[model samples]
Target: MLAVPLLGLINQYLGFLAMIAAIVLVWKDSPWQKGAKVAATIAAMALLGAVLPDPPEEGAAGVARKDRKAAAARTLTSPSPSAAQDDPSPTTEPRPEAADYRGMRLDEARDKAEAAGFGTSDHNASDDDKNIWMRSNWTVCFQKSSWTGSETKTIDFGAVQTGAPCPSTDGGAIPWPTMPELTWKTWKTARNEVVALGVVPTEHLRADTAYLNDTLPDEGKYDNWRVCATDPLEGADVTINTWVTLELTHPDNGCPDPSQSKEDRVDLPDRDDDGDPDYHDPFPGDRNRNSVFPNGLPDSSGNSSGGDGSDGDSWNCPRTRWC
Candidate 1:
C-alpha cells in the first residue's frame, strides 16, 4: 500500500492523476467491490506518493531567498577599485616624500638639513643611554615622531668637541685626550655661568647640564667627564662669540687648580674637594684672572658661536631634557 514503489513506476504527473482517480473510484462502487478496489487503488496511490520527489519545505524556501538576496547585493555593490576612486574623503593624503639622512632618522625641521646634504651619525646604542652627541656639530637633530614619521630640530654643532677621537672600548687604552679639556669643575660650574652670562637661558642651561650628566662616556671609566665646550667660552668678552673650545675630560681634570702643578700630575678628587679646593674659572680666557691674550688662548675665531645667532634671544631653558 506504500506509495513509494508505485510512484517510482509511474511518471510524477501520472502519479498525481492516479491518486485523484483512486479517490473518485472509492466513492462510486458497490460496498464489497468498492472496498476491494478502493483498498488496491489507495495502496497504489500511497506507493506513488511515497516515491515521488518531495515539494520544498519552509526551511528550503528561506535558504533559496537568502541565496538570491546575496547575489543581488553583489551585483548592486560597486567594484572595490572604482568605489575607492569615487569616494571624496581620502584615507590618506599625498605627503612629501620622506628624505633619507644617511640612516639617521628625520624630523620636519631637520629635513632642511638633509636637503642641504649633511650626514648623521648614530649615538644611541642602548635604551637607557642618552645620545647628547646627536646635537653636536650636526646641522640638524631628527626624532622619530611615529613609527613612520620624523621631525627635525636644530642642534648646536659648535658645542660639539670636534677632533676628539671617539671613546675607546677596552680598559688600559691610553685616553687620547681632546683640547680645551673641561674639568669636573668646569662642567659643574659652567652650566650656571652660561645662564648668568646671558648666552643661554636657565632652562637651556639645565637641559645642557642634564644632557651631560645622563650621557656616559663610552669607556665608562670616568663617570663625571662629559661634553663641554670652550669655544664662545661661557663669559668671554668678544664682539663675536669665537674662541670657543669644546672637550671631554674627567671631573678631576676639570678642577680649577690641581694640588700638584702641571709638572707633577696630582690625583684629582672624584667628588668636590672640601679642603684646599682648586678654584678655576668655569669659563675660558681666564676672565676671572684678567689674562687677556689677543686671539684669546689660541682657540679664538670669528665664527665661534656654533649655532645660528639669529634666534639667540629665544634660547630659553628646555622644558624637557629628552626629545
Candidate 2:
C-alpha cells in the first residue's frame, strides 16, 4: 500500500495500477488500519492526476494554438499571390497595325515598317520583277500585307524609280521601259539613253584594242568609244535590273561588220570645228594638229603620212604650208 502511491509518480500506467490497488485495500479487507488505507488511497489519486496528460480545454489559449497550427498548414499547402501572378500562362503577341505606303521613298518606307515590327520586301512596279538595288532611288507605288491578329506578316512593296509615275494597280506583270536603238551610237549617248530611264548598262570591250578597263584615262570618258551591239538588241523591253551589255570598240577601230548595217548607222554630230567627228576625236578642239588634219599630215622626216602620228598623238609641224 505504501509503495503503490510512490510508484504512481513515475508514469500514468504505473499511477493507474497504484490507484486501483489503493482503492481495493480501502474497500476490501487489508492488514493495515482503515486510516492508513484511506490515506494511501488519497495519495495514489493525487499522484495519478499529476502524472497523466491533461484533456483539451475549450479556453482562449487553446483556441489561439489551434489557429496558429491551421495557419502553418495553409502556408505549406498554398502558393503565394505574387508567385501566381509571376507565372502566368503563355500568350501570342498581337500583330502590328497596317498603313498605306504609297508614294513614300522605298528606303523611308522600309524604316517605318521595321519600326512598327513588320518585315519588308520590295520589287520593281514595272512588268519586269527587277531587284531593288538602290532603295533611295525608288518610290513605293503600292503595298500588300495580310495576317491574322495572332501571327506576324511581311509587307511587300511595289516600287518604281523616284521620278517615274506609279502603276494603275498592284501584283501583276509590270511593263518595263523600252530599250532604245543603241547600235553604232557613241558610248556616251547610249549610256545617257539608258541612264535617263534609271538604268546603267555594263560596258564590255568587243574589239581587240589598246584600251582596257576603267583604269585608263578613256575609261569613264564615254565619247572615246562606240557601241557595236547591245545584248537585248533595239526596241526590247528592259528594266533597271535587266542584264545590259554594251559591246564597245574605239571609234578609230570602227564597229564590226555584223553591227554596221546601213539601217543601224547613227550620224554623229560634229560639235567642234575639227574635221574629225566628235566621237572620233579625243581632243575635239582645232588646237591639236591631229584634230586639224584628221586624215593625215605629210611627214617632213619620212614617206609615212605623219611621222609617229599615232591614233591619239598630236603632230608638231610648220602650219605655213597647210595653213
Candidate 3:
C-alpha cells in the first residue's frame, strides 16, 4: 500500500513507464499535452517493446509538403504565362519583281514600270522639245534588259518605229536640243535617230567627194547609204526645231579625182579666210589672226598661205576659216 501510494503520488516509478503512459493515454486519464509529449511517449513505447508506434502514413500532410517543393521548383525553371503572351512573333517583307514594257506606248510603259517598283530613264530623248508625235506615236523597239529580269535603275530604249503596234509618224517628230552620238549610222538611220531626239536634219549631197558606207541610197534600199558628217556636227547640242545638216556621199561608188582643184569642191563658207570653217572658227572675219592665237599663227613657224613670194613657210592661223 505504501509503494502504491508513493508511486501514484510522486510519479517517479521507472518500471516500463511507457506501459503506464500508453495506458494513461488509452484510458484518457491524463491531461492533454503538447505534440512533443506524444512523440516522446511513442519513442519510449518503442524502446520498451510495447507494440512499437507505427511511422506516420503518407496522408494529406506528407502529400502537401511534397506539393509545396514541386511548386517552388517549377517557379524557378519555367516561363510565366504573362511573359509568354507579351513576346512578339517574327515576320518578313515581300520582294519586287521585274515587268515587261516592250511594244507599249511611252506613257503606258512609264506607268507600268512605276507600279512594279522600277524607274524609267529616256536613253535618247529631247525633253525640252517634246512633240505630240514623239509622245503619242512611238513604241519601244528595244530594251537594255529582258522584261523578266530583276529590277534596275533605267530601262534603255534602242529605237522608235511607227507602224501597226504604234500610231502615225506624221506632223514630224520631237525637237529635243540634246547632243547625240551618231557615228557609223546610215543616213536614214541617223536622220530617224536625231529627229526622234527633237532635231530636224538638213541633208547636203556631196557630189564631188567620194563617201564611205554607201551614202545617199534611194528609199528603202538605204542599206548602202551611210552618213559621213553632220552640220551641228555629231556631238554638239543644238536648239529644238533647228536645222542639222548631214553630209552624205558614196565614197566607194564614185569619188572625184584628187588631181582636180580641191579648192573648187563645195566647202563651208569661211569669211575670216582661216583654215577652219566659219561655223567652227572661234574668231571669224579677223584678217590679222592675232585675235585667236598669240601671233595669229598655229605654231612659231608663222606659215600663212599668202602668195606674195616671201620664200618662207606660210603661217597657219589658229582660228581662221580660209585665207
Best by TM-score: 2
lDDT of each: 0.39, 0.65, 0.49
- Model 1 TM-score, 2 decimals: 0.22
Q: Write the per-residue lDDT of candidate 3 for residues 213-296, one digit (tens) a residue.
A: 222334555544545545565567565334666545442333333344434444445676654444435556653443345234
What order do you get sorting by TM-score, best first? 2, 3, 1
Question: Which ranges of candidate 1 are over 4 A from the true structure?
Answer: 1-14, 17-323
**Residue 46 shift from truth in candidate 3, angstroms:** 12
Candidate 2: tens digits of C-alpha lDDT, residues 1-323: 55554675666677688779778867687787878877867876776776567766669778989899999999988879988898887888775566888889999999998788788888887765667899999999988887647766778888988755566766455556777887777777877777666544444222222223211124565465777777666888675556666767666665546636534444444555434556555545542334445435445554225324453233333553222
Superposed model 2: Cα runs more than 4 Å off: 1-100, 105-107, 110-139, 144-167, 201-217, 220-224, 249-254, 259-323
lDDT score for candidate 3 against the true structure = 0.49
lDDT of 1 by residue, 1-323 (tens): 33436656668876677666666656665355756876777677777767777889999999999999998999788567777677767567543433433223224335455455433223332222434444433222222321222443223111112222222331122233222333444444544444444333343332122122222234434334544345444444422122323334555334223343333433323132222113222233222111122112222333222122322232232573111
Candidate 2 pairs with clashing backbones = 126-174, 127-174, 127-175
Query: Local error of candidate 3 at 218, Å?
Result: 10
Can you give the lDDT of residue 131 in candidate 3? Answer: 42
